[model samples]
Target: YKLIIHTDTLIGLSFSGVHTWLEMYGCEWDDQTGAADAFDQFGYDGEDFVSLDLKELRWISPVQQGIPTVQKWNNDRAYLESDKNYFSTECIEWLQKYVQYGKSSLKKTVSPQVSLLQKSSSSPVTCHATGFYPSGVTISWQKNGQEHHEDVDLGELLPNEDGTFQKTSTITVTLDEWKKNKFSCVVEHQGKTKTENEIRTNPEGSVPIGIIVGALAAVVLLVIIGVAGYMVYQKKKGFKPVSGSDDGSNSSAHTVPQA
Candidate 1:
């Protein structure tokens, strides 16, 4: 009574018992060598039956009417040999059991996304970048050292409903190539390639230190207004000229003597 049928119900009971055992015993064999001779006439001792257990075997009425069509043609040829090796883990567990029995259909195709941001106004440099399968990305802008892609500006590419896609790019430089020179962000996808760079140097403002402290406080206020106008011109040229008393003394006393 050793009935054991499983190797996926032995390919649908080897095609419904080889078309009813080839119209009652006139066989010829083909469907993969008649399913390897009907799993050696049912008692499959093939060493590997992929976890067998045909409901406690013991079937007869033509192997229980070809065991569920040979276990659905051995799970559709082991899901087409695990989708031709997509790093099969048993073809992803038989496509998660053919999408939990609803008999899956399959769909998924995403690959696109990239990013990079840069700014430099004399040393305060900043550059961030990213890119991965973004279909085909390209960005460029440089100065002080050359290479400027037409005023530079590119952004807009956001799609993710599983289709995959993203974008971001910016360029604004100065302060000596944003401090020094070298500034870049180039990416090209679909063929695989990437690049990112930054080199800084410019920084020193405050109106040039307030125009050198307003020209040294206007030359110390013109040397304190020329020493306060030369001390008010020496106190109006050292005033005082009282000469009336010089001869007055003699005239008054000698009026009656020496005329």
Candidate 2:
């Protein structure tokens, strides 16, 4: 069954006029129950503009601004019938193929490699989790063995080129703060947690030069994203591509063991 809520004033629907957007229609099917669902939704600037009512097999407009186009689409008998047939049959076939193609990789889970990174002495310390499968992980910081939240920055879940995923959480702390308290990074993935002391005092008075220059581009990027948010694409509960993440070529990477 299709889910549609109708009210006179477009109650919860948000509309935007500044940007233009259009979402391709979506279709879903259940293999075991032989059930099917379909939707043709259009959005403009993140606003729900219009959608097709599969139950009535007609186009319905949530807001008044979309009415004119809705009227035109609802009047097109051939277009309506063609859409109905396509969603009921063609879409399901493609969805099934997609399920078969990615099922093995999508169901597999690989443990992540966790590390703490700092571009320079003054840069924010980052806890990085990479080479994990299925794209879900939790990266957090702890001070004195307790959860620490202030001045923490959570990064976007990004894809890697090797079919795994990577993520990072960064924290800004002063040299005095580090000297006064113990700081650690905790990464939880697939029911296991890895906790490691993120800051180390190099008695040699120097860190690998490559480590400082390693991922310089990424460090600059983190500063930009810390100030301005990054773009994220919303994928429905279906198949999507995941390219491997580029874990930089820093030879002195300190990795924590999985528990």
Candidate 3:
């Protein structure tokens, strides 16, 4: 027997008296000729094949077939007919929870909004502080307890492509003045004031004083040795000492006849 199902009504037609078992075995038939060949090989009536309607045949197997296909069809229909408003509500709720507790949040916080450039030295004492920023800023200089304005050089503000600005400031003074002075750069932006100060010192001139003292000591020692040697020579040769005259009152001195 051969059976075929092609409708949503789930009807199956079988030929011959080979029953469903033969139909199961003959399911590999490719066409009408193949079905007739299988029937002949299985000892079924090739000339008198019977037509069967399997629509009322209740499947008695323990395993229920076609479950996965039915479930897929149902899911596709549901997705086609359902509204997306429920999903949008879920997304809004998730965002609210993230904003409330900062959990599952993916936003980047703004940085400290500051950068310091390298201070360049023009003289042994004076230097220029240069940097860039994202907005308008202020720059100033202070020496000791007084504000320094004269001789302070301020560079022109250059606007960056990202709407930020940069500027440089220079101050000139003696190395000694720099050591005694305190220089600061103040920036005012977004209603906030930030200040950076650089105090100068003579690192190169602060060499060891002990070295100079040691050199002087060596020169004094050589001079003392040379003077002592000259005094010893004058005493040994009976020459009058250069300091003062002898009194001639010693016991070793005697009166001598005139020669």
Best by TM-score: 2
Per-residue alpha-carbon lDDT of model 1 for 1-259, expressed as tens digits? 1112111122224643531111100111232342211111233323221222222322222444456544653455443332232212222332333344443222322333233322224333332222233334555555544676644566544333232344555665555544465666655655554555643322443222222444455566678779987865555322121223333342211000000
For model 2, state the Cα shift of residue 11 in Å: 35
TM-score versus the correct structure, for each prediction: 0.21, 0.44, 0.28
Q: Against the hidden true structure, what lDDT does model 3 obtain?
A: 0.37
Clashing pairs in 3: 16-49, 16-50
RMSD of each: 48.3, 15.0, 47.6
**Rank ordering of all candidates by lDDT, starting from the highest:** 2, 3, 1
| lDDT by candidate, in order shown | 0.36, 0.66, 0.37
Residue 154 C-alpha lDDT in model 3:
71
Candidate 2 residue-wise lDDT, 1-259, digit = tens = 2222111121233474345545456577777787998877777556888888987998887889888888887778887887777677655655665676678667798998887777667777778777787778989888998999999999877656555677778899997897799999999988988887755433344543323343454566577676553232222222221222224222121111110
Q: For residues 31-125, what per-residue lDDT tens digits would candidate 3 score against the true structure?
A: 33532211111111222222211222111222234334334433443332221221223222323333445432233221223322333343422
Ranking by TM-score: 2, 3, 1
User: Of 1 and 3, which scores higher on lDDT?
Assistant: 3
Candidate that beats the other on TM-score, 1 or 3, i.e. the better one: 3
Q: Point out where model 3 deviates above 4 Å.
A: 1-134, 199-259
Which residue pairs in model 1 clash with each other?
12-69, 12-70, 13-70, 122-202, 179-200, 179-201, 179-202, 180-201
lDDT of 1 at 161: 28
